[model samples]
Target: MRNIRIGDYLVEKQLITQEQLENALAVQRESKGTKKFGEVIVELGYLSEVKFAQALAGKLHVPYVDLSNFDIDGEAVRKVPETLAKKYTIIAINIKGKRLTVATDDPYNFNILEDVKVMTGMDTDPVFATRTAINKAIGKFYSMQNVDSVLEGVQAFSDMNNAEDDEESKDRVESAPIVKLATTIVENSYRADATDIHIEPFKTYTRIRIRVNGDLVELMNVANVVHNALTTRLKLISGMNIAEKRVPQDGRFTQVVDGTTLDVRVSS
Candidate 1:
């Protein structure tokens, strides 16, 4: 979909009440005329500058620019090796017959694209998106690829480490419950590709936090009290008393990523 402004989009999406929007609009019309929603929102105190930026970003459908995208010039991608491109998660999004559309928050992504053109002899077009939007889209693309399933990938990793079979590892596959939970989190995380897992105290709030390359790229506030259930389940699996939370605890478990099992530590 083409980019749309977040305030207008949210109003259209029914995410904010019409009255609230009207108030914001009224302030904007009075204080600033013809300015973008972001600027006006910040001036009128409808939202904090950071939040306004974030919302405006939602409207812009671009990830917030950061050091990662800024560091690589898009023009250089034209000469960058395809092997390196894939390894680096560098890709052309809108590839047509002869021309490819590259979406990135970084202007430098275009430089990279230019480098790729010289190396592979492919025509490329550079497009810009917010870091958040690009990461969200990329995560979806990778999930569709399904390079590895969490359980199978973890088991392979364990064997690679020559880790002997233990009760936990042996029953890992058999315990459909734990596997299912881990798989859901990992899959959802990959889909959103969020940086952190937001475990809030809300009853039905399941927010997935993804930070790609060191920025908070996506936040999926899923409306289902999945956190309570998942946290409880995790506590039980880790041999912690589910009913107790007065004391802070630390524990960890292993899961697979990219055909390798990696340890995922839990902290409260």
Candidate 2:
């Protein structure tokens, strides 16, 4: 069978008009290789991301994965390193015998399949998923590792500086572990496509949760000592008044993740 082009397939299926395809093509050209044709169409509002991905999967004769409801296999996720998965925007979702099934937004990129196969020593099965879904899965799965060590580091840092004055504590908030904790929380939240990140203080510990797909999922809880430093780091980056904690404050910051700029709004 001859490989079907996404644009031609969409037009043949009446999903998009020829005029819209041409317009998207013009936009893609204007991007000067920065964007793919599918990306241009989605960005141009001609097709929803999921719709485009499904159409592309049908055209490519590959299975389409709805990652939002999919139960990811932890063993499969471990087959692909986080760095490799993030680099290629692909995630291993299942493993059967010598075959590894991975989901990617760009099923047309056979190079990703080959790279994964070589890295994992398995026959690769490529499936289609929306970029957002794959990104969210990557964050949700990969970020779950090493949590205990991270919290331990935070506790150690906080313990060592417990005797410091307020000014000194403020300076220590920029410590390596604290910085990593704050950065990880924000970056993970962004990659997970979370609408809100909740950091709540309780009597004993601080709870961290993120709202994804309209549901709140708890990420982790840390010592109350670590909470002050973590929130301080976040406030510093978001330009909030760290000293004035009694009043509600709002701030916004921009983060660039995997070449995409994300505007993050913070409330405290």
Candidate 3:
């Protein structure tokens, strides 16, 4: 954070391209040095604000705040004086005996947060957020009390209420056909108590098998169309490069089965 630039980090992480960075830099230059590189990239619709903040949090080792699901406390808002809040571009989100949780865009500005901890006589926990979200909190709790600045809070609240079913529905909607199929295959393997699920690609068909009790048991065979999609989906879930078939990669993820989370390892 002190020496490495954010753009290079994003590019190295495959979150953005070098071309996109150059274009954002051009936009920043054209702004007469007014806009920050991140602001330019976000304003140009190159990346979502939440994702940007998440990457920044990972790089800076700060906590990321998901504003869509945050519940603002009115008392917490008042703990930080309106003048200081606006001046430092921060908003208090929660407060305990002598510990205050605050959201701010600039986590590097430790002076402002130190002053806040001193003024309130409390320890401070910092969370990262987009500039806009902090402003919405300020508006909803401080200056513009009557403004409807929920930022999809109603929808998010409903999601929280029906979280389990809602999460499955949302995952289904976001997942491709092959992803869903891959999920089903893994679920079935879990139910069957299989040690390994194997998918082998052939010219015209694909063979699916499961290893149970040290024996490979035939599962099913699928046509070319299904096999291609299944292969791509498997690569995606395993965090492998689907574009490169010759490369060997390894990745692992956790899957919940019958209310229990299980680690599922994938390799190719």
Candidate 4:
């Protein structure tokens, strides 16, 4: 598949109103493909960026950005079997004598080769192309591994990260002030006695809408690009290949809140 922005893809496909297309396209051109379409639209004069981001975020099946300031690993990288890593893209910057290197589907990210070299204190190289191209290259590098299966496992973990099958709501909705996404959804569900929370994906973002009492209500919004990053991070955390996205995947987990153990299920 092409490493393309879906707003561009949707516009080319003629799948939306020109006004909508122009709004999205304007956002894309302004960002020059760096800032996400969701963010750009908000900056430009289009729909209320918040609502649009929320709807788009839900459609994209990703989480919203929160106000909390927690430590996040900035330089996060995974060590896959070089065999598996090389299966998807070509190692454009293969410094024969260095320990750390940068790999990206877009060779353009490699435009700053000198910067990377100076910052990391290691030789810097770049990989350019699509996930499919990288997968093919890695397959040639290591002929025995099943890249497809590895990808499936990764998607499975994405499901687990986003899933929610927690406790049953008892109908007495507690009116303690609103909290985070998880808390709001869980609390609303418990009070309304809902079964599942459905998250979906869109072109340039993901929406965090909730389903309670059999009705759907938009909750929070997040950029599609952010969601994409999160899904990749989740895959890496669950020991799955981050470069593969050809198939649907599922994963699940559990959390204890208020002395109650609840199951969370995620899928993509």
Each prediction's TM-score versus the true structure:
0.35, 0.83, 0.51, 0.27
- Against the reference, the lDDT scores of all candidates come to 0.52, 0.84, 0.72, 0.44
Task: Residues 1-268, candidate 4: write the lDDT tens digits.
Answer: 4555646554455544567867777768766779766555555655454455434443444433211121212231222345334433433323346544444443344435555555456665443333433443333333323333433443443344432322212220111211123343444443333566665668755676666667887654454433554444444434454555777776665644323466666666
Highest TM-score against the true fold, candidate? 2
Candidate 2 RMSD to the correct structure: 3.0
Q: How do these models rank on TM-score, best leading?
A: 2, 3, 1, 4
Question: Tens digits of per-residue lDDT for model 1 on 99-181?
Answer: 65555433345567666577667786655544444444444444434424543544443444322322233344335543554
The true-versus-predicted C-alpha distance at residue 84 of model 4, in Å, is: 52
Residue 105, model 2: Cα distance from true site in angstroms: 2.9
In model 1, how large is the Cα lDDT of residue 100? 58
- By TM-score, the better pick of 2 and 3 is 2
- C-alpha displacement of 31 in model 4, angstroms? 63
Ranking the candidates on lDDT from highest down gives: 2, 3, 1, 4
Better of 3 and 4 by TM-score: 3
Q: What tens digits encode model 2's per-residue C-alpha lDDT throughout 63-125?
A: 999998888899999999999999999999998899999999877687998889889999988
Q: Judged by TM-score relative to the true structure, which candidate is superior, 1 or 4? A: 1
- Predicted structure with the largest lDDT when compared to the true one: 2
